[model samples]
Target: MSAMVDTPAAQPLPRRTEGSSARIGALAPLSSPGWVEAGRHLLAGLESGVLDVNDAGGVLGRPLELVVRDTAADPQRAAAAVEELAGLGVAAVAGEYHSVVARAAAAKADALGLPFLCSSAVLDALTDRPTDWVARLAPAQSHGWRIYAEFLLGAGHRRIAVAAQPSVYWESGTRILREHLAPRCGTVIELDMGALTPEDVCDALADHGATALLLLTGIPEPAVSLVRSVRADRRLAGVLVGAPAGQPEFGPWAALLGEDGAGIPFLRYLPERLGPLGARVGSALRERLGRAPSFVAFEGYDTITVLADVLSAGELSRERIPASWAGVAVEGTRGPIRFSRVPGVGVRQWAWAPVQVVDRDPAALDRFRVLRTG
Candidate 1:
């Protein structure tokens, strides 16, 4: 079950409905071409205890139910899904994947005064939203880049090399780099690999070498192309360090990079640190889906955990939820997660999990240890 949608999709504008209830909905590309696998994982997580819905803070005395609808990755369809959920009288929504879709969905959720928890959308667009009802669980990619820059600069490396895939995430990373490096008294050379072919990406990597390299982009295909190509370069053999893509999609690349990727830092919440309950979640997902869970599973899990915590505090209302979320923090598979009221986006801090490449399992890692590498 790959998590992808139909080819040549379009916008899905969603509308709100009157009245609100305790029902919570998950809007995503469940029926999309490759999404069945991820959708099943999400469903499995919800069915088991991973994304278990709290009984409206356990105050309502009735177990909460999660209603999911497939957006097919179409923006208009995504809007329709939210309209339907809003019509269902849902109090909140927990969704997975894509910052673009999340932005549309979050807009709908906010109009209805329903709480929106973004499990996978990392685009600053999603986080930069000003809605009080919206909160992003993932740390800002900029924060991760800033952390990476600090570490690389402090190591006494004057010139730095960076590679990006021209994604919005990569663009934001580049922006952060310029801002951070410009002010930090450090110099850097960024390798813009956007629109570059696999061979071109590799050549770019081989061409540049000064300090640590920051490969910014989560697109697994091209990232794999470049990582393998550059690691093979004999001249650049002993490059100091590299930061994995900020998003977990780079898990596959981690395995490809092997030893050099050993000290590669990424943002993730390892299953081990999630404790007894988190492991149970991993087992539950594997049992149902028959494949190990990754960031996708953890994302859904974190969203529910956070919403449940907020609900448990008191009645989940528009104003109250954000108020409580102001100082709230939850340890998720990604890292210590929290959000602050950033004028545009409701909450601002994204967590980082510095994982070292142990062996073949870039997908599976040593414990998610938080080190100040970025």
Candidate 2:
């Protein structure tokens, strides 16, 4: 896909028929370079959301339809998808797990005056300036990472090392961890994964006397290697390994690493317990996904739930949807869904979705144990 072109004027809503569907543009990273497992779970939730909505009579008695696009984790592809979706007269846009890609999509959607409810992107600034055109369901990186930092402190890790790849998203996360930990007498050691090997990272942890090493690198390559190297190092045997970016939330991380993957903490947006609505949604999502649903999947379901509420509130015009964000109050699978302006975030945020520090249990690699919550 190409880069986003000049902003187009807001297109009129498509003509409705009694049998015609209400279209929503769905974006996901379904190919390489993107987290394909995360995308599959996200799409399952999105598709499941549409199914539930249609079963409930959909928006204004029209079936809710998803115009799915594979972003492949490219910002250019995502931006272009937004333009195409806007031109297609989609009532709104939703779903993107990658923060950078979501930023591109959000910017394009904002420019095109297309209302977008972001599903799982947690970057603090989804847009450069505040815009009613975009809103997000996931807690901001600052919010969630701060919680993870707290978890680290409570776990007695005052010195931490981050093996990070270069990216705006990773940089922001590192910054969040550093800033949050600094005032509390904690130190953050930066290991540039671009210049260092996984063995080098393990050596750094031993030399720096850091008690925790967070994986801020991409999955299956540096991240997987770093985990293996650190776990194998006798000098760093007691060191805590974490991935605050939620890499361990999906199946592939466990599938590849097996017992080696267990006990590595990560951030997840979910409550301690699910309500009746959540239980039903979880069961349906499990059936659709052929496995347990990650928090990203629930984020997808909630994205459509919020959008459906906005569309059903009154008029289904594109212009009307942005305004409806403030008025939104619906029961999402996670919890009560509402949007409000959060400090440092440009888009209307869910205030917070439930945040947890979780890791797969060593005794049972398939099960997750909640280590902390915020």
Query: Of the candidates shown, which would achieve the greatest lDDT relative to the real structure?
Result: 2
Q: Per-residue CA lDDT of candidate 2, range 308-362, in tens?
A: 9998874678877777888999999999999888777888889889999999999
- Candidate 2 ranges beyond 4 A from true positions: 1-9
lDDT of all predictions: 0.57, 0.90
Prediction 2 global C-alpha lDDT: 0.90
Return model 2's CA RMSD, one decimal: 3.4
What digit string (tens of lDDT, one per residue) describes model 1 on residues 229-286? 6667666665654554443333344455544454455544343345666676677666
